[model samples]
Target: MSMSLSTLGALIDTDHMLRACCNNPKCRHYAKLDLEYLAVKLGRDHSSMRDDLVPKLKCSKCKSKNISLILSAKSTEGLGHT
Candidate 1:
C-alpha cells in the first residue's frame, strides 16, 4: 500500500518500510530502518509523533545530518518491489 511520512506507530500498523534518504545532493544514500526496533528504542509515544525522527537521522555514507524520511512498500529485501 502507498503511504507517506507519519507516526512510527502508524507505519508499524500499516507494515510499511521506513527509509532514511540522505539529503546531500552529492551523497543520496538510502537505508531501511527497522520500525519495530525504533518504536522500542525511541518509545512508542516519542516515535509516534510527526517528523520527530528526521532531526535525529544521519547519512551513513556521507555522515550528514541532512536526512529525509520516505515510506516504501514492505519487501523481503527491504527495497520496494517494482
Candidate 2:
C-alpha cells in the first residue's frame, strides 16, 4: 500500500522545527525555522494552513511560489554527545 503524504500539522507538532526549501530548480535555497513561528507568519486559522502558506511563501533568491517544507535533522549525525 502507498503511504499518504503528511500534512503541515503532522510536520509541526508544536515542538520540532521544519526545513523550508525553495521549489525553484534554479534557486534551491533553504532555511530552518520553528514550526510555531512559521504558523504565525502565515496567519489565519489552522484549517488549510498549508495551502495558505504556499501563496505567501516566496524564495528570497528567485521569489518563486514553489516552496517545499520537510522535517529537519532526522539523524543525530553531527550532534555532540551530552
Candidate 3:
C-alpha cells in the first residue's frame, strides 16, 4: 500500500499548520506573535486566523489562569534569592 502525493502533501500541510498554530503568540501556551503576523501577511482568512491563533489568555495583562489578566506579577520574584 502507498499513499498518493496529495495525501503526503496534505499530511505535511497539516503538520505545518499545527506548528504554526502552536507558535502563535496569542496561544496561551507560548508567546510568539511573529507567526500570527506572517499568517495575516499571507492573506489568510480572519476566521481561520482566529481558530489558529486565538488569544488563549482572557487577560493579556496578568496572564493568570484563575484571575483576570489584570493581575500583577510584581511580588512574584524570588524573595530568597541570594
Tens-digit per-residue lDDT, 1-82, candidate 1 = 6754456777787767778888899999988887888888876555643367876667889999888877666645545656
Query: What are the Cα lDDT values of the candidates?
Result: 0.73, 0.59, 0.33
Clash tally, candidates in order: 0, 0, 2
- lDDT for model 2, on a 0 to 1 scale? 0.59
Query: For residues 1-82, what per-residue lDDT tens digits would candidate 3 score against the true structure?
Result: 7632122233233333222123324543433233345444533333332433344323243453322111112244356788
Give the per-residue lDDT digits (tens) of candidate 2, residues 15-53: 344567998878899977455665576542443334655
Which of the predicted structures, 1 or 3, would earn the higher TM-score when compared with the native? Answer: 1
Give me the runs in candidate 3 sitting further than 4 Å from their true place: 1-28, 39-41, 52-82
Off by over 4 Å in 1: 1-6, 48-50, 75-82
Clashing pairs in 2: none
Cα TM-score per model: 0.68, 0.54, 0.17
Q: Which structure among the candidates has the greatest TM-score?
A: 1
User: For all the candidates, what are their Cα RMSDs to the real structure?
Assistant: 4.5, 5.2, 15.7
lDDT for position 49 in model 2: 39
Superposition TM-score, candidate 1 onto the true structure = 0.68
